[model samples]
Target: MGADEKAQNKAEKLGGKVQEGLGKATGDREMEAEGQKDQSKANLKDAGENIKDAFKK
Candidate 1:
């Protein structure tokens, strides 16, 4: 994957982790779930990028 895509995915994953931690600390289930969703979306995007890169090869 390109540098920009990688950076965005990393940033999104990091943001999700921070959100999850905060939610756990605050005892907010909704926030925690949202964070998990964000992380999943980021992972999906990363996988798609990897697939595209593989096809280009």
Candidate 2:
């Protein structure tokens, strides 16, 4: 909902994507799982923000 929060979430998601790609390229299952977890966390944060914004309205 906020610009800063949005930016942080986007950055986190992007970082996760990069990490995921790196893991895939190198065949690291642990790293790939971590990256996926990061992405899921970022998504959850974004969803929470959206819910808060909706309540604000």
Candidate 3:
């Protein structure tokens, strides 16, 4: 995976974690769910990148 793509994915995951924590603290289920979704999307992107890298190898 490219460094930029990896960094972006990491940042997205971190942001989602922060959002989830804040949502939990504030008792906002919708926000928490959104955060979880964001994290999942980031994870999927990272997995896709990894697959591409493996194929390149």
Assess every candidate by TM-score. Answer: 0.96, 0.96, 0.97
Cα-lDDT of candidate 3: 0.95
For model 1, how does the per-residue alpha-carbon lDDT over 1-57 read when each residue is reduced to its tens digit? 999999999999999999998999999989998898899999999999999999999
Consecutive 10-residue window with the lowest summed lDDT within model 2: 29-38
Clash totals, every prediction? 0, 0, 0
lDDT score for residue 17 of model 1: 91
Question: Candidates 2 and 3: which is better by TM-score?
Answer: 3
Strongest candidate by lDDT: 3
Per-model C-alpha lDDT, please?
0.94, 0.94, 0.95
| Cα distance off (Å), candidate 3, residue 22 | 0.6
| Model 3 alpha-carbon drift over 4 Å, by segment | none
Candidate 3 local lDDT, residue 14: 93
Question: How many pairs of residues in model 3 come into backbone collision?
Answer: 0
CA RMSD, predictions in order: 0.5, 0.5, 0.4
Clashing pairs in 3: none
